[model samples]
Target: MFFALSKVLGFFALPSNLMISIGLVGALALFAGWVRLGGALLVISVLTLAVLGLSPLGNILLLVLEDRFPKPAENDNRPVAGIVVLGGSFDTIVAGARGEVALNESAERLTVIAELAKRYPEARIVFSGGQGTLFYSGATEAQVAARMFESFGIAPERITLEDRSRNTRENAVFSRDLVNPGAGERWLLVTSAYHMPRSVGCFRAAGFPVDAFPVDYRTRGYEDMTRPFRSVGEGLRRVDIAVREWVGLFVYRITGYTDALVPAPL
Candidate 1:
């Protein structure tokens, strides 16, 4: 239910939603109360529309968020105990239940997982996900992740499954319960670079020492911030994703699901 609640709360967290709501309230007042209030609402909405259309506000938002979290590679010389793979849009599909796989825009995690399988054959592989659905499906997400590994020739004998997690916090908590991580057992956490902060935070919060190995780097721009942000749609999409993760982080902290302020070791 935390999962469902968080998803619902995210809708209210959008800047667009706030703009629309103000316009809506102004319209409602015009019908029952004041004409001036309605006019003010219309004015505000028009100004917002003009600003969003003319500027790279979305890119600026995404660019700033990406800058806030720096995911530099660690310069450590230590053998990892095991590799923990986090789930995302990477494996969500109609074929997920039937052992079929399709790639998200960034298929880096899947390829990186394959590399981990080859490099550390003896280290246990843990797959974490749940049946995060409002519709019927024959299998859990963990099953889908497992089958993808099967296609890559990973032995079923070496796989550990935690099929009841709906997000990163649960991914860490449930997988920890399944794997029983030992002290000094270093782990390489594989996920998109943009998502590394929350994933790493969740795992460490749940008592797992994971080295962040971020892939699928998304934020990029010219050294000159003055360059035109021509791709407003793409910029908006990135901003949306960044906003969602940040809201998720704050929500997790408030309910004690995570400590968002804790400086995550990136």
Candidate 2:
């Protein structure tokens, strides 16, 4: 719901949208003879909106934001319990109407979970996430992940699941409640590299300290960055996500969600 609302906010709240609304409102206000500055405001708003609406300039701003976000790391320590993978994309976590499951980006995330689960058969492999927009019927994400794991031959008893969470915050809280870890006991938090900081912060806020095992990095290695004339669209997307996370770290820290906001283990 928040994601949808953000899309709407980003769209209708654009300067163009605001200018259109203002123009209409200003015209309405003129009948009351109090439209002195209103007309000027409308003109400025329109001009500003026009430029922002057409150009891909926000993409440049996104690049700056991306640079400001923390770096994500690939760590070596294995948790006592296995990793808890956060479902971010439909490929990572989604269900068909008839309840079929699919695994996308089966790399540093789902595949890694499977590998670890196979290697550490005794460890508890918890699946996180509840039903998202596709299934409003109230199924949790963990439920879906468990089923997927089951198809791969892991027993129901081996997998612990917390599917009641509606968002990443809930994902951490609910998982923490299930794991019920003591001080100094570690659990690994697995999610997209772009999403690790927020995931770690949320879990830390809930009082569970999980080592971040960042995967599915969208940003390529330095060799990839060496290419000049990188597409602005992709760069802007990375920037937008990184910027949001940079802000997310600050917000989580200020709200007391995390005790520390350490960057990627460089």
TM-scores of all predicted structures: 0.78, 0.64
For model 1, state the Cα shift of residue 223 in Å. Answer: 3.2
**Candidate 1: C-alpha lDDT:** 0.68
Model 2: per-residue Cα lDDT over 51-141, one tens digit each: 5444444444333323333432335434456567787544433355446555555335665677667766777787777665532453344
User: Can you list the residue pairs that collide in candidate 2?
Assistant: 129-141, 130-140, 130-141, 205-257
lDDT of each: 0.68, 0.61
Candidate whose TM-score is highest:
1
| Candidate 1 lDDT by residue in tens digits, 1-266 | 75676666666676556567788888898997799989899789767644553455555544543444454344544576788887764446565544567556667776777877777777778877776654455466677677788888998888887888877888989888888888878777777776777777787788876877777766565342343445544544555666676777776677666656433554
The number of clashing residue pairs in each candidate reads 0, 4
Residue 193 lDDT, candidate 1, scale 0-100: 70
Model 2 lDDT-worst window of ten: 64-73
Which parts of model 2 have CA positions greater than 4 angstroms off?
1-79, 91-98, 102-108, 132-139, 223-236, 261-266
